[model samples]
Target: MTIALRRRLLAEFTGTALLVTAVVGSGIMATTLSPDDVGLQLLENSVATAFALGALILIFGPVSGAHLNPVVSVADWFLGRSAGTGLTGRDLAGYVAAQTLGAIGGSILANLMFDLAAVDFAAKDRAAGHLWLGEVVATTGLILLIFALARSGRAPVAPAAVGAYIGAAYWFTSSTSFANPAVTIGRAFTDTFAGISPASVPGFVAAQLVGLAVGICLLTALHPDAGTAADQVVAPTGERDPVLGHRP
Candidate 1:
């Protein structure tokens, strides 16, 4: 692997790890602080997640576009294939692997931090048709928001916008917006407030995939040339040409 690609992969791994850490860790803390009120626990968890997500994006946006989510990476690859501007097939594979591993590690780390078993598999059963629908809606909206910002020359605001949308989706969506497949898998490692049961992973992933398809279709209809701006999804990276302001 080239030095640049390796750096990008490292960024992906670390960024995703930290993002998951924020999620799982904050959830643990929230439950401790608000043990009696599920509502307050969710409020704290969602707020922390939103802030952490935006900060992580700013910290790693220059590297690997801070995708931090498999669905986002896949969407970037598919959307940019024709334009030759987003992740290549090899990069996509590497990113997904890194993200998944990072997520698991983050979950383990969160458990360890809370004096809990490091590898406790989550027992939170989230299987239900209504929850599946929520996942679909959440993922679809996430995809649309990220790409819309890119396509509209509003990429700079993505950190805040994306974060805010997720924060809001937490209350609005039935599934609390676990729109990321890697995150879902990671959350399965903990039985905490933020975790999901492993048995429900396949269904959530399938719903997310469906959401991706729907989001892509809507994005294309709204911005017929959206592919040309695929590299800007989430945010522009350091990989772009310094002179021309885009990938060459």
Candidate 2:
């Protein structure tokens, strides 16, 4: 593998790991702090997650576009394929693998931090139809918002915007807006406040995929030339260096 691709992969892995750490870690902390009130726990969790997400984006946006979500990476690849501006097929595969593994690692790390067993394998069942529908809506809105910002020359604000949307989605969407397949899988490894049952993963993932398709269709309708801006999705990182495929 080329050095540039390797660096991007490393960024993806580390960024995703830290993002999940914020999520699972904060959830664990919130529950401990607000053991008596689910509302307060959620409030704390949402706040921490929103802040961490925005900060992580700013820290890693210059590399790999900080696409901590697999759907976001996939969307970038699909939209930029015609223009040759986004992730190549190999990059996509590498990114997904890195992000997924990073997520699992983050979950394990979070558990360890809390003095809990590693790989707890969450038992919280969330197999309701309403939750599945929530995932679809949450994922659709997230994808649409990210691409919309890029298409409208507003990529710079994506860090805050994406974070705020997710924070709001936590309360508005019944599923708390997992919206990410890698995250979904990672959360399953913990039985904490932020974890989901392994048995429910397939339904959520399926719903997210459906949301992905819907979001892309909506984006094309709204911005017929959105593909041209694929490289700027989530955030702008400038032209890739000839040798590193990253901004110098």
Candidate 3:
């Protein structure tokens, strides 16, 4: 593999590990550490989620593009954002695998910390218009937030925006912002406060994908350059990518 590709993979692995650890680890802590206060637990989870993601972006935004969520990648990919140094099937395959493993690691750690057994599998809570709409709206907002952030030369905080979106979505949206397919799947392996049911995975993922598509369309209209596939298509070597600049 080329040095660039190796760097990308390394970034992915490290980012995934941190992302999941923050997510799951915080959840475990919230439950056991502050179960008495529901609001405090949620707050802890939200803050941890935000910082964990933010730190990851700061750590690997340059090397791997810091796309911890596959939905973000898929949205960009479909929008023709993979013009130059974009993901090939090989890159995506490795990314998905790494992300999944990282998520599992997070979930397992959370389980160990919290002594979680199994989930009630709240499928019914997420199977209708409200649920789907929540996904669409939440993900639309999330993707837009990220795309706009990238466009505005603020890739450093991409993780925080993403993390904050998810953290806030837990309360604001009906679906709790399962903004990522890999994350949704990984959450299934653990029977904990963060676990989702396997049965509900299809609807959640589908809704998230729809949200991404809609977000892309909206972004395409708002930012014609990204839509036309002319900007932010590849990692920058000499300078920042036009859409997501290359600066500290």
Candidate 4:
């Protein structure tokens, strides 16, 4: 209801929309430029994802905290880290809705742009089991990286860290590290070379969330940052974020 809350929601929507656009647009391009090799297309996709995320963060860091993922938001909430740019229940709900819708719309746009909406869910280069492992490892790495950067007060430049983690995960993880659920949903709309089947969505989301939980547990084992004062408040809008903020 407040102006700050509105801005925060708008920030969330804007961040999500931009991320989806980059993802879907790149996939469309990859389909054309690298039609013969899917691996090459994926490589292009990872690079684009990293740059898009990094740029978006640099552009939007001062607004809405750039929390484009539900897990990040939930993490912030649980840690009492709500980046009090002025958030309320209604605002949070609107942000979540806008993010999800932005993702879907992004897919549609990509599909329209290059006929990149054709999803061949049956294109079996790898088994579903392997894909599941990819999701697990990719998501875990992302969360752990986020946790480490946030704990270190390096989240102000988190875009770079987040981008590199995702880009690297693409090479290492089986599923190309589609860790963000919002992103996954948006990709689904395209049904293009980057699209995942409706059937894979739920499983991917579940597994990614689980991986994040595992990372959080791991965070507890490490000691708090030595530089920060004992009473340091890395929550809300103090210095950085712990549960939600990304790495940089």
Tell me the whole-model lDDT of each prediction, alpha carbons only: 0.90, 0.91, 0.68, 0.65
List, residue by residue over 1-248, the lDDT tens digit for candidate 3. 23366667777767776676677678777888987997788788878887777677766765677777777766655665444534666777777777777666666665665666433332333457788888889889987887676566664456566667777887898776768877877677665556677777788889888998899889889976563331332222123455776442
Cα lDDT tens digits for candidate 1, 1-248? 12288888898888888888999999999999999999999999999999999998998887778889999999899999998878889999999999999999999999999999998888888999999999999999999999989988998899999999999999999999999999899999999888888999999999989998998899889877787887786878865566887765
Pairwise lDDT winner, candidates 1 and 2 = 2
Each prediction's RMSD over C-alphas, in Å, is 2.3, 2.8, 4.7, 6.3
Candidate 1 off by > 4 Å = 1-3, 239-248
Model 1 weakest 10-residue run by lDDT: 1-10
Off by over 4 Å in 3: 1-3, 81-85, 113-128, 227-248
Q: Any idea what lDDT model 4 has?
A: 0.65
lDDT at 136, model 3: 88
lDDT of model 2, residue 169: 98
Q: Clashing pairs in model 3? A: 240-246
| Model 4 worst lDDT run, 10 consecutive residues | 227-236
- Cα shift from native, residue 194, model 2 (Å): 0.6
Regions of model 2 farther than 4 Å from truth: 1-3, 238-248
Better of 2 and 4 by TM-score: 2
